[model samples]
Target: MPFIPHTDEDITGMLDVIGVDSIDALFDEIPKELRAKELAGVPSGLSEMEVTQLLQARARIDGEPTCFIGAGAYDHHIPAAVWQITTRGEFYSAYTPYQAEASQGTLQVLYEFQSMMTALTGLDVSNASLYDGASALAEAVLMAVRANRKVKTTRVLMPRSVHPFYRRTVRSIVQHQGIDLVEVDFDTETGQTTLAHCETAGDEPFAALVVPQPNVFGVLEDVNALTDWAQSRDALVIGVVNPVALALLSPPGDWGQNGADIACGEGQPLGMPLASGGPYLGFLCCQQAFIRQLPGRIAGKTEDVDGKVGYTLTLQAREQHIRRSKATSNICTNQGLLVTAATVHMAILGAEGLERVAAACLANTDRLAQQLCEVPGVEPIFEAPAFHERALRLPAPTEDVLAALAEQDILGGFDLGREYPELGCALLVCATERRTDAEIAAYREALASTLAIAEAA
Candidate 1:
């Protein structure tokens, strides 16, 4: 796509067709008070070569590091074919399938994506995809509150063990709708949410509870007990999980009692890359009973008039299908490209391959944690078993230690002190199957040497 300069006459013709006086007039629909006048300090223009040079310089500022950081987004190894086929003109340039019949290929891709997500989460239904994991969990909270027939209250329980960013995102979303997010603390030693915390939460009229499996510290929670407890109180249990971890742990749909009502999580582990924060998508799934409350779009398969197999968009729960006030979510656009990549990734790695990948991740993580803890100043903060990430207490400030490692071009881990103040100097590290033994060794050596330097200073 080459850029073509629009002539004055072309602009005038376009404005005339739209009954607008100028390009600025087209933005009249947006409130003038809310509009930004301009990007302050931005340069007017530059030659293509000059702009390219500027961008290249900016990109060089971030040094390449052997990434051990996995707070949420992971550095998993993506197959070469995954992106090769995904970027093909057909999938790359695709748009929303407004007319399902005409968009059979796109619809089928989404249908397969939804089917894979459902199988992964052990739920009856799954929407195509959501913006990201944080927003997806927020949407799940909304869905649970709306579908809860047992309670009229919007008070929801969120675990402290869940990712801090996710908790904050949920608060921002549901607070305006009269949803009260109650914090449930985790055991300091085990890094797991104790049932005692919820038991003490009292008989408040709550509608939903979020359970994060293998939480931020990577310690697995007691899913069965947590789910059963929420069900006993007539509150819907929403599981915030890792898609890869689901291959090894019990799926949300089999939690306890009647099982969790909704399961949502970051799908980056499935196929998407970190891409420096994200271009990653979220997956949302639920039991059949709450299928109508599922946000975004769902695709269904059927036979057409000619008896040929076909796929079509089905049960759209967005504002486009119904009144805005009654819609499940207004933010309901599927991550079509990322989902296509994910769908292809899943197809390539079937059930057995997925389990093997997950098992390998566990093995690598265990090995890394064991080696790192051998450093004098480092010790595993949590006694419980964690999948791929573990919190370690460092003798020095985590940021200082991380900075030293960064100098050597090794991305150590997440500084947990920022999110978990109680655990000072805590470092949360993870190692996926993508991390080779040599890379793990390098990280260990860097951290040990960095800590030694800090102590000497």
Candidate 2:
């Protein structure tokens, strides 16, 4: 689509209507330093043919290296059918269906997505979607605050071991809103986020406590224990889970069976590509009691006069559109396109297939870790149970190691120094189903060479 389709006459009409002499006059802010000095040096506008070739060439350039990089968005294998169905003109072009009648198809997909998320989390109610995992967690916090029904609680406990980015995001969203983020410590050796660090009182209490199962470090947490700790107070427990890990470990709902209140997580592993960080779906689900407090949309099934089952947007009262400040949450738009993609992916890979994918990820990560241990200067950080990712403390600084690996076209893992400075020279590694045994061996060989070079230097 032409972003600005202005004909000569249309431009003239607009300028005339605005009483402007030339377009440059509109930006006459009297700041030469800020504005480009003489229209800048560049080629004249290209013809359609030239522009197409230039863009195609740029698109073909491979930016990311040939190996691992998954903090949250994984490098899992996406089936061809995903793209085939997602690219359908009808699904691609559809936007928010304000009119329930006109958007039945979209509504139905959302309904199914909600059902699947609910089933996956083992929660009674699931919202259609939220923005992404971070936003979903922020919404979950707000929901917990509202559920308190007492004086708005000032503090919420988040584990230091949770995704550092997610903790930062939660802080950004709630700081201005007058909420204190209490950082709970984790067992350095075990990599478990324990609730013992939090000091709660009857009057001055936590509104909610957010912890990830198989947290950012990839260690499986004793979620039942965490849940029990939170419930002792009236604090709501929010579990930020990786949907794929549910296959190997217990689901959050089962954690709820012990005592969890709400669940929120990134749904990217279900089939969405990393896509350079997103357009990924954030999934949120809660117990039936908290359904009214959940943010975003909910598609419910209803019957028509003729006795046919039809899906329609239900529970509109919790959103900003209806309740404003008093709304359950301000999340206005659910990631419709990404949510549909996740739904399709889930349908294609049923419960059994999901387990297989999870198994592959687990096995690959184990292999990667095993190979890394063989390298002279590398050591696995913790002796904890991880789902499909882990951290390795190397002999040299992580950046130096990363630079060496880049020479071999291996992307390598995220560096832990920026967040966990205590873990001085650790490289966080992730392995998904997409990584093969041969590729892992190559990574091992490359990493070994890099370590040796760094040591010799």
Candidate 3:
């Protein structure tokens, strides 16, 4: 743990052992112009004490807001008890439970986490965790392809309204594997994934269909009908869902009961911080039919020789440690700490409490949407009811309105026009349980004034 700089002798010995003369020779393939002369803007060196103070000072330049800005990563009220419990030394700096016999506590927590995720998603089984929601979805897609071995066409149909990041993540994962990626468009009025478009796209011999519940636009999909449509064609249906929405909305496992193969989503809103976007948990769950295709390690309950109940890693086919390159997925590590935080948060806020949280968030979002609609230039873009997020069309350009709102230290909604040109002046705004009545009023007032200026300009 002590800092010791490598001496000339040490470098010489290492280089000689590797048959290399100089460090620069290691980058023979890198273009000369691309190589930095001296890390141009950075200072060469600083004393340890100076570096510490510099880092502290730089960190003091906080970019975080004191108020609401919930999109994907929310601003929920994390209980102090969560911090108190998760910070315990036994759990805080723990590593993976590779040695099953030695890591009983670690494995037990993971088992509990898996059980909680199963309950949340309404799936029969759940994996320990994945890196994040996007990766989980990518893994699910890969799993579907693997399950549909008889299918000649390796195609996955995703919705255009699925989180743009999730879509990109799926594409990135499948592109190299030679799977066809089909993105279903939205019904312009509902802002929901179009089943008509899916019917058109689903004609091809496809491996699976990926749909999100309370999708990117926050419009809930008809999971039953969608799952039926996919299964009728003998294709796997994967739903990327919001766990909070699942409290009020139908669970994807319910879709599995109606016939879906996989369910996955980012578990951030359950109890993780925005932390400028992550260190969040990725939840993947499914019925026993496709359990073999589940990507991450699974924690299953069992009885020891003493006849006492215990937990251990089970059905771990996707991990590299078990199967190497031929594995279903290569996610070596799960989001353990984040998953533990969520498990604790969920335990404290039981079923009724979780539903109450969801209801409060939905109520706040509805109220905010109604208030914002009063602004002359602002109008709700979709007719369908959303859970805790919505898309609104500004009478003026989104950039102008956002810039004006930002001047008041209010982070406005994400601009949809940036990604979908035909969406015109639409902005995607989200509100959660954390946004107070006063803050919602403030955001409305700010948007009203900002919109007036935008329209005039």
Best by lDDT: 1
Per-residue lDDT of model 2, residues 308-393, tens digit only? 88888888877788889888776788888888888889899888889999999988999999998899978988888888888899
Candidate lDDT (C-alpha), each: 0.88, 0.83, 0.82
lDDT of 3 by residue, 1-457 (tens): 1376888899899899989999788898899889876677876677889999999988787654434455567778887888688878877887887667667787898998888878877778888889889988998988888887557567889888888888888888778898788878989888877669798784677888898888888888777888888887778888898887788887777773475668898899778877777889888998777788778887777878999888788776657887999887877888888878888898999888889989999998899888999988688888887888888888888888787888787888787888888889988887788888888899999988877766667
TM-score per model over all chains: 0.90, 0.89, 0.88
Query: Which candidate gets the maximum TM-score versus the true structure?
Result: 1
Regions more than 4 Å wrong, model 3: 1-56, 63-68, 149-152
Off by over 4 Å in 2: 1-49, 150-152, 199-204, 256-258
Candidate 2 overall lDDT versus native: 0.83
Question: Which candidate do you rate higher for TM-score, 1 or 2?
Answer: 1
Q: Report the C-alpha lDDT of model 1 over 205-321, residue by residue, as the tens digit.
A: 799989999899999998999999889989999999998888888999899978899999999887887887678898899999998888888888888999999988777545455
- By TM-score, the candidates rank as 1, 2, 3
